[model samples]
Target: MSLSPAFLDELRARTSLSALIGKTTKLQKAGREFRGCCPFHNEKTPSFYVNDDKGFYHCFGCSAHGDAIRWMTDQRGLPFIDAVKELAQSAGLEMPATDPRAAKKAERQKGLHEAMEDAAAFFTEQLHGIAGADARAVLEKRGISAETARTFGFGFAPDARNRLRTALKSYGDAMLVEAGLLIQVEGKEPYDRFRGRLMIPIRDPRGRVIAFGGRIIGDGEPKYLNSPDTPLFDKGRTLYNLDRAAPASRKSARAIVVEGYMDVVALAQAGIGEAVAPLGTALTEAQLERLWRMVDVPIVCLDGDAAGQKAAMRAAHRALPMLAPGKSLAFVTLPDGQDPDDLVRSKGAAPMEKLLAETQPLVDRLWQAELAAEPLDTPEQRAGLKQRLADLIRPITDASVKYEYQAEFRRRFDAHFSPQRRPFVPFEKRTGGKRPAGRSGWQPALPVTEDAKKVHAAGIDRVLAKAVLAGLIRHPAEIARHMEVLGSLRLADGALGRLFEAVVDLAVEEQALDSTRLVTILARSGLGDVAGELLRADTMPYSFTQKSADPVRAQADLDEAIAILVARPEVDMMLADATSAMQSRFTDDAFERQVALVREKQALELRLANLVQANEDARALGPEEN
Candidate 1:
């Protein structure tokens, strides 16, 4: 069996040299190629290079060079025939049958090439000829320039079926039929296959015309038509504009995959020359392999229409199972109802360029696509979402890449449904514990301003509440231990209440916030001014809130202040009740109650008096404490 040159090129194009060798030798990306220590020789620094573009592995150190077939034979000890057979199978190519016509494979291929090229030239000339004026008009209407038309070999097949046959009779009917230019019916003459359509020539890697694609000139069925799978053309294996795109991709460091030939042509016209398109089918794994040979991550530009989004989704799903580290796809969907052609024509190229520049990664697109697939409100639904994510992750071919993707999903899952802390709520009037947890109190600071000397309008309770809140901002680490108790406190100042809630939320969200980071986070969350005012030393002359301040003394002052604040409210209620009873016609029991209430009020007043003296003493010793 003889393998044709076209088949060999296809085979090599379908293979990834880095992957083939990387199975055994560790490899790392180096720009457009992969590099590692030469597997053939022992070396410390990497001197080996495997270039997917050139389809070969080379060692600068040991002077080794070979293609995949040769690597299999020399590196893996496979025989030549065995290597060829294995590669053909992997590339989805069948071994040619050994027939008497096998020896004339080259001649037969040459004849097919002559016929296809002739058809392409005839189509072009006719497109320029008198009969092709309508096709030329169509091109002009689509904004296809003369230079682009010539560069891509735009042409139009005559409406009549036999017009091309008459023009290319020299290549003979048998050759024309074999080239897929004419379709044959049983017991009937073959006629031109593409009729009344604008023609596009598909070229091989070396820029040889291998097949033709046609777009109907006007309203018709089968909007786009491609050449059948002939000896020279396999639509599934071919990407439109790849011959030009491969070289262009190297310069831009990006390969773009669109959905159609006009999309490719439109981008090239807009100065984006690295665009390609699958041949009338969803992007295939083989085509993806070919794209990776040019650039690391190629971008898939789809239209924003529903069908376009579905196409983008289809490509993403096909790519998921094939993902490896440093090898994945990026996606950018154009505006609704706009393909690349429409986008460039309507908005110029800057918008499209900006969109491509900000293309999302594969995993992000995956998360977004799957997340939007269904609503995740219930536990079962959320868990199902996780399972969907895991299902997508499970297909990743690389173990390390799979693990990292799993980790990414795990992070997203946590962010979505982790135990939600109570939303940041402003402090409200509330009754909590009647006493402090311990001797919670704080240290005193040097009076920062005359403002600090102002007496609390609500007296020591307000002063103490302000003091405790300020201490937390100075020492956020102390928050974790007293979150519940602090959460229960109700402050009189509304702004101060909001600040308290924000600080508690911050503490709960981040368990290990230091004073600096905590303050920064709060400042970023629109609380900079609030935090500043609440934490200002000038708010209270006797407040201590510096790195050098004693946490023990701070807790002591805070606890004592809390106990007094909580107990003061109860005392007021008792005094009010006793005062009410004493005001009414009272018996001996009511009289006793009044005496007891008076005693309680006196005791509470004494405690408040001591708190005043403690503040005075703290103010006096503030300089010494600092």
Candidate 2:
């Protein structure tokens, strides 16, 4: 089968050479290409390389080389047709039917390319002629040198209607209309589509003029206009200045995206050659993919105005679903009320270079955009912010990148919303060598209080203690309700006491506390091990300890457990005192008191036992009930 060059070009553009060659060889990134040991010959060091941007593979050691089709036929031992078939299938493209019409279509497209080139040359001649005096003045006013204009193939469209129609009349009116150079109506004659405008040719990767972008010289409704999509041009898939920018990007190890063709030209004039621009539209997925083929992270430098920021956000949203490891976008916002063109004109290229040097990653820009979307002063607004973030990251297809983004967003959310902790200072330093206003200079050192001694004497139920602490950690919102009662209580285990104190302090510090943020804070404070121990599945048989338990039910059960825990020590202390009094002086009242205290302690223990049994039943019923 004789395949058309158009179909073959599409195949090459769609297939990633690195990925195709990587199946048999371990290829590591080496600048703009991938390098690995030569698969064609025995070698210890890497001498083979693949350049996806150029769609070719070369082996320095064995001189083995090919494109995707060559690799499939030579290495995989398949025929030409089979190789094309396999690549077409993988690229989600339909195999072109065996027909002579496809060849004719390709020939016609080649003719259209010739027509576009002729039109470009005609416009360039007109730009240097007498009719282009106004165009030259416009370029001069914008600080574009004659040399720069010549390098970029700057041109002009005369204000008259038939200037191009008469110049390129040999290509026929049909070819000119097909090339998007002339507009045709039902009965009216086809005239030039661009008039009284400065022209910039849009070229393909091979430097063939595919279309033109025209900027109105002065006083126009639309300041800029682009050619309609034709066989040679798909605006969404094309980036302005890509033919020149690709090689420059490979050398710089970076690529930049600006808002307009003029900005790209300005940057190029300033010796910044690795810059391109979308064709008067928001950045698209095809353009982003094209950029990634050149560099790992391309910098998108949009204007700093509201529309520019919105355009940047749109680009970010377009990139999220396609993000892969080491393949993402960075962003740069130019100074206020200025674009790359304006900045270069005012302060030269240093500020533009500095901004590019310090570009923000896609994640930071996403966070800032969402944070500034609305005021997060209310609970509802804050929750909306988190929900928006979740929605934004949900589209990320790469598992590892998605996970990292989630973790980073969570960390940022906690850092932004959680209150800052005060730095610790010694009491003497804080007081500046003076006693507190209400306290005497010399205060008595008190002995171990009665409550502390009683807490030590009454051995705690280890299982119940774990359950209560875990419940509090899982449901941090309930901490404030029980803070006063818990403040006066003491635990015998030093680690457990420290954990309790930390929890209480966190509750006091953060107004909006969640379980994840609470655990994160505890982990940062070196209480992670203790917290982890308490949160173990086998450590407690309680609904509140389960992570997926219902919030209302968890809070209620946690409250009951806390009540029982707090009242137990008092019952134990009263019981001990009554028994001691009875032993000291045998009396009926003392005996009665000891009996009542014993009954109260038994009731508390029984309640604790029932609560555990209820939790066990709930656990057996599964998470629905919990």
Candidate 3:
């Protein structure tokens, strides 16, 4: 639920920005403001200044300046709502519900939070109080120090029925069931799912316990067992140790992503504190994108075994296209047959530190890994490897970075696979005018049909509407140029339209829109794809260096694209059928037929004009065209 501007203003006034930020960074009295090194970026100079009177702070060095909320958002790398929630918690203030649905969702989240807190306390008690000696011994045997165990809130669940059920009696049986802390049995009773294990509480970025990760204390089928999906926890959506790592990320300006919870814990314990791990999943695009926001670079730490190597390679492949020139990755490989936990235990924190210090850049590691595989002796292998390298490099929009990678790929490909005399044969067939001289009409290697195009176009439109709304709302001047276009068009009627409406409404009410509020909206609207598309579209603001930057020019370009789409031969055929149907409805109106023809002619004329404008060498339109 969105707070009123007046309410937000009041909340901002109530909280002391200087005091809140002073707790983290050492601030000194300047003339009229407090000054300190920026917390959000690495800097030696005292560029970050906070003006208590203005309720704002600015970093002259980095230009990271904003209001109190923006300051917290920058510092924590959290969404605005998350930052507001953080600040509200600190102030012991409740968020006023602005809508009924939001109020209900908030109520559900509070229940889940309470359940998780209860489960954590119960598990913690079990570790120390009774029937947890065996689990403690297992930790000792694994070389986990008592201090380390306490630091991570390590615990165990007894191998018995209703342990957590009895512990969380206040929240109700439904709470425990929903929280995935207890599993119901048909005849007997509900039992704790994470019994006979060393517990690792999976906290959110706010440090609230959302789920648990358990390591087998005894001989068990699965080495690690995690809490099942609940209203609060989705393993894929979270990063282990994000609570601790996020602050470190903001300070250090980088984060290290590892393969396991142990890797994250061990690294943090080892003083490589800015480390997090994906919860029992591959390093996803979503996880990577989120990490990039928190840190300038995210080093991927993978295991040394075959599976680890594969995981690392997969991460590198996923990350390459997203890598900007300034952004980067490093690969950390633990010793053979060892994970980060084991390495830290056997070799101590110093060795782990040394490993991080000696980590290889992702590009170097990826190149070495690719080259380490079977020889480029065969033509097929050479072609396959070259294609694989190209697939990884082409999506990056940065020309300099792409060019560097392209040159590096070509050099490496030549060094590894190229025969001394024979030229490398292209993998994909060339098409269009570039095709072999004897070839007839250029056919798409993979032609998307009209049905596919319609579906894809709808998806693209959903993404476009969300993106355009976000852009236009942020830049008010854009509203006049784009609103009519947005209003005239029809998108796929569903959750996406609802979300677009919500954003537009928010913009209308607040005169500014917060992207975070849209998150819950998008999630509720069942528009995850649209949300993901919006999140993933890393659009750089257009600079008015070209004619395309003008609103008229840009819209004209868009209109042309739309006109061409409407005037497609397939579309023309479809329009003919539509017109015939309309004719039947009209009964006997020759004027209707003429009017339809005239509209079609106008559309064709627009398409022709666009073609001519876009391509100066295009043919001219005559009076007959009208």
Candidate 3 lDDT, tens digit per residue, 409-518?
65565444422333323323323333354333333222334743564455333333444544443343444444555455555677666656655554555544444554
- Where model 1 places Cα greater than 4 Å from the true spot, the runs are 1-3, 7-100, 419-425, 428-626
- For model 1, what is the alpha-carbon lDDT of residue 87? 87
Candidate 1 accuracy as lDDT: 0.77
Task: Name the weakest run of 10 consecutive residues (lDDT summed) in model 2.
Answer: 439-448
Superposing all C-alpha atoms, what RMSD in Å does each candidate have to the true structure? 20.0, 14.0, 21.4
lDDT score for residue 54 of model 1:
75
* lDDT, model 3: 0.67
lDDT of 1 by residue, 383-402 (tens): 78977876776556655565
Better of 1 and 3 by lDDT: 1
Candidate 1 vs candidate 2, TM-score winner: 2
Top-scoring candidate (TM-score): 2
Candidate 1 accuracy as TM-score: 0.59
Each model's lDDT: 0.77, 0.84, 0.67
| Higher-scoring candidate on TM-score, 2 or 3 | 2
**Candidate 2 lDDT tens digits, 238-309:** 999999999899888899999999999999999899999999899998899899988989999998898988
- 31 Cα displacement, candidate 3 (Å): 22
